[model samples]
Target: MSRAPGQFTVVAPGRVNLIGEHTDYNDGFVLPQAIERGLRIAVCRRPGSRALLASDRGGPPLDIDLGAPLLAGRTDWGRYVAGVVAGFQRLGWTIPGFEARITADLPSGGGLSSSAALEVGIATVVETLAGQALDPVAKALLCQHAEHEFAGVPCGIMDQFAVTLARRDHALFIDCRSREVAHVPLGTEVAVLVIDSGVKHALGDGGYAARRRDCETAARLLGRKALRDVSSIEWPSLEHRLREQEGRRARHVITENDRVLAFKAAAEAGDWPAAGRLMRASHASLRDDFEVSCRELDLICDAVGRLDGVFGCRMTGGGFGGCAVALVDGPRASSIEALARTACAAALGHAPEVFLTTGVPGARVE
Candidate 1:
């Protein structure tokens, strides 16, 4: 396709939760980094108040009426784009009609926040056309709201925040409740290996919402505003008061929050082993307590964790099969990947997509 006269591109990175899982919605802490793989959107203004959207992923072009009400029964990807447009309208920003073509290396439903990358990338496109930049936090929140209101997912601030505000060569330490952020350097000693298990997770399934509901019920039962209010020291005494499932949900959030802080400390001190241990523990909590892991995720984590040069391995993302992340010694990364591929292929009949990635800057116009 020929470029429009004033066309520009926006790039947004997908993120991997290095440790904390499912704790974001509980108003807890999370440590995540934006990975180098993500979406690229080439966009330019059009003549009228309608938006035309297309993707290299092969779908009919989505033409959205900017002035019309959001259709309840639009296609999944279309809903995401329209959601962002609705968000911009809600903010009183006058968005012009535009044509955007999205191409991405990020794997959708692999728990790398491809959906957030798309939303943020489109929002950035709108922001660029509007001739003003929003505060980073507000930009992230706007995308988050799009997910909640349009995508119908009750996600926490972590994914959008990391995708919008992440710095290169750093992990974002986010206090989901306060919206405070700290950039922790991911030094040169360790490498982050992300393994796609080939199992896609659709959070729109009731599994995700069910877990969130359990956490809320647990908090109400414990007389706390949210699980974040319940300290680690206080959890044991309160654990027995709730039913088995609710208690487990609450336990995961409380302990995961603690692990996020400890992992931050380990990262700051350049302690890869300590950070790896925390990653393993976080995966266990998500698997046993949060009940989000599937056999593919468990098998991959177990196989990778047993390998040499791998500091730690665990299932990442919203679970039920997406990806696993490992912290490995930088020098042994290639060997580790080879061994992991052989082992996983032997067991699963096919090798997974395993690659090394580092922290990269968040969404921006190019």
Candidate 2:
């Protein structure tokens, strides 16, 4: 096959959340694994000053005007890609224009960090074309900036950090406030079965942003910085302090934080039963209080909850619609997947796409 001269191959990994829902923005702990599903970006020099960006989904390259601010909002999904270019430039990461193509196995809107995988893939390719190497944290921050500042999603660092820096065969425990990284071993003996609800969720849909606002308001009601700053021991006094609007929000946060901590310990100790229970509890809190999970997500959770080999299961993304995570025994993995698919079809009248992938590394240019 004839190849373009200056083509740099880039690989960016996706992520799986083992525990911690809506906890990253709270500056709390999130444990996520970098799964095998990811995006690949290929870049080569283009003769003209203008850059061309394309994806394997069979579309023309998005020609971004380099001289323009690049900060302007975009209606198309291409903005996520262009936004990375803007982030690199703003942060003074030397970069050059190049023709690019992206291909992915990661399912979009599956809540599996598909967007982060794309951003990292693009950023890695862009930097490689510019002959600039970035540290892991720098790579994460740039991708995050692309989503938040450019793509206009108020997401936290879990997806980016998990994709950019997570260790193979492990989950990363992130202290969002301090930005501390901890690599916890995820035993390969267990399997992570990701079942898609096939429900599409926009981050801003179903008042997701409004829920975030409520969280902040709840924090302020108790005189804390964010939900992460609050503790379970102090919930009584804080709960009394908050009225209807704030009390429920504060209650979810306090208990959710506790669940995250316990889930982390359970995962570390290889206590699959405890972890599974925590997953159920977290889903309940998000459903009843946080108002994130929907019918499909709840259905999957309930279906998985009844299975024997299923250790833990819960919705994995921004909610209102998306996929859920289930921990299953290696031996019964297939059976669990089959039953989950059957249940999903029966519950929602549609089969779903599911992935059981191994944990991999961050993006790299080859």
Candidate 3:
């Protein structure tokens, strides 16, 4: 195959939530890490008025005018790229028309941040082409805005932040309200595995949005600006003020944020057992109080929760259906996978895709 000269390659890694589910949108805390799997964006200047975008995953090419208005109602993957281009323009960067090809090893709905990888990868490519540099903070916030305004998912900063600023072999501990990030290393002899439940979820649907609304209502009723301001200590009294579901949502956010902080402390002290216990507790809260879990997710967690070498297992994404992560002994990783597959097939009528993963570096130019 003939290749164009000066074609730039950009890589943005996907992320898995180690803990802290559904806490991001509430301006709470999240522990996420960039994974080995990610998106690859290759680009070269076209020297014309339009930009051509195509993907190796089989979709029609998107031809966009360099000067056209950036619209928000797009319902396809191209919307992600268009959103980044629009973001660059909004940030006053000069981006020439270009031909770009996208490819990925990341699964779209496996609870990994595939969309953020695409958006950030394109933003990096655009910045390189424009001969300018955007700092990590600016890059993350910009891509987050792109998702909100263009992709129509009111996602939090955790995905973009982890994709842009993650460190190798470390999980990012971020306070969404403060935007402060800390990189905590994984201890030796520990392994992280993700088991894809073969279920996909769309966050734009009412389920995700409805949960966010409940949190907002909880905040308003408490006279606080956000659920982040409410302490877990106050949950007992606060639960009586709101309706059952709203109170449960508030309880999850406050308690989950606490779990993240405790987990971070435990991880820093090389206390894998404590960290694993926190993860199990977080999943229970998400399932019971938050009500974001589905049967498939429960099956994975229940099956893996009792394995001898397994430390903890819990559903890892925005919920309803997606992947679950398990922390286990490095040598026992394969055993856990086999156990999960057998148990899931017997209980859920299907087997899951289980694989091992580790924390890797964030997005960058290749």
Candidate 4:
């Protein structure tokens, strides 16, 4: 597709959860920040009921009809665009069908929320084209809805919220139940390192949903709205009544929420060591209790643990496989990354992809 004059470009960022994992759905707290890497969608209005979309990732240009029925099957990237368009329509905004060319620096399937970046970026484009401004919070919710209704992923609000509302130089402390945000500054000289284990996971593919179901079961058994309302002290009283897996799932959510709060306080106080300790503990709970971490993710985190100048490491996304985020000494970032690479390669027989990045501003039209 050729670039059109007057095309508006919007960039939306991917996020790395620093200390919270799988807690969003439980209505617990999460600490995440937008990364510099993200996706860009360039859009411009067209004359008819159809829109065209092309991507730098290489695929046939997608032709979509604004007034037509949803496609019968998943069309890869097309599903994301169609989902956003449908999202707007559901809001009673009849946006013009347009042409879009997507460009991205985010690593797809690395658990950095590349999908949320695409969804939020395109949602911004559609909202802009309609001459309507959406509140960031509402926009984030709509994007989450799009993923659930259109993309078939029962994702929580963390990814979309971070992509749309994160501020530069700070991590977002989100109360998933209240949808309240607090920007916590990292005052220490720590840098973020993301190591992609070359292992990919599609959360909608099943495991994620199963884990969610387990949580739901625990909540029902405990007579709570969600596990978020259940205290760690109250969990043991209900644990025996649940299946072993359900009990473990409940334990992870309750305990992880505690860690998120601890990490937030540590981050704000420039206490990197305490924050790191919580991060490592969070990963261990996810691995042993939640049963989400895969071998590759474990190897990457283990590699980081042995490296000096690294505060902590853990699998940062929905698990199964993705990236491990490490908080490292800013001045020794290079050496820590090199050590992590060598260790991961030795264990996995191939070097993992590593990115050294910083917190960046959230979505905006450029």
- Check candidate 3 and list the clashing pairs: none
Question: Against the true structure, whose TM-score is highest?
Answer: 1
Q: Summarize candidate 1's per-residue lDDT along 80-160 as a digit string, tens digits.
A: 888888888877888888888899998889999999999889889988998988898998998888888777889999999
* Of candidates 2 and 1, the better by TM-score: 1
Candidate that would win on lDDT: 1
Of the two candidates 2 and 3, the one with more favorable lDDT, higher being better, is: 3
Q: Score each candidate by Cα lDDT.
A: 0.90, 0.80, 0.86, 0.87
Q: Quote the lDDT for 253 in model 4.
A: 94
Question: Candidate 2: worst 10 consecutive residues by lDDT?
Answer: 65-74
Q: Per-residue CA lDDT of candidate 2, range 255-282, in tens?
A: 8778877877887898888988898888
User: Model 3 residue 366 lDDT?
Assistant: 78
User: Which residue ranges in model 3 land beyond 4 Å of their true spot?
Assistant: 1-5
Candidate 3 residue lDDT tens string, 242-306:
98889888888999999999988988898888888998998899999999888888988888887
Q: Which ranking of candidates, highest lDDT first?
A: 1, 4, 3, 2
lDDT of 4 by residue, 147-178 (tens): 88777889999999999999888899999999
Q: How close to the true structure is residue 257 of candidate 2, measured as C-alpha lDDT?
A: 73
RMSD of each: 1.7, 2.1, 1.9, 2.3
Candidate 1's C-alpha runs over 4 A off are 1-5, 69-73
Q: Give the per-residue Cα lDDT of candidate 2 at 37.
A: 78
For model 3, give the 10-residue run with minimal summed lDDT: 1-10
| TM-score-best of 1 and 3 | 1
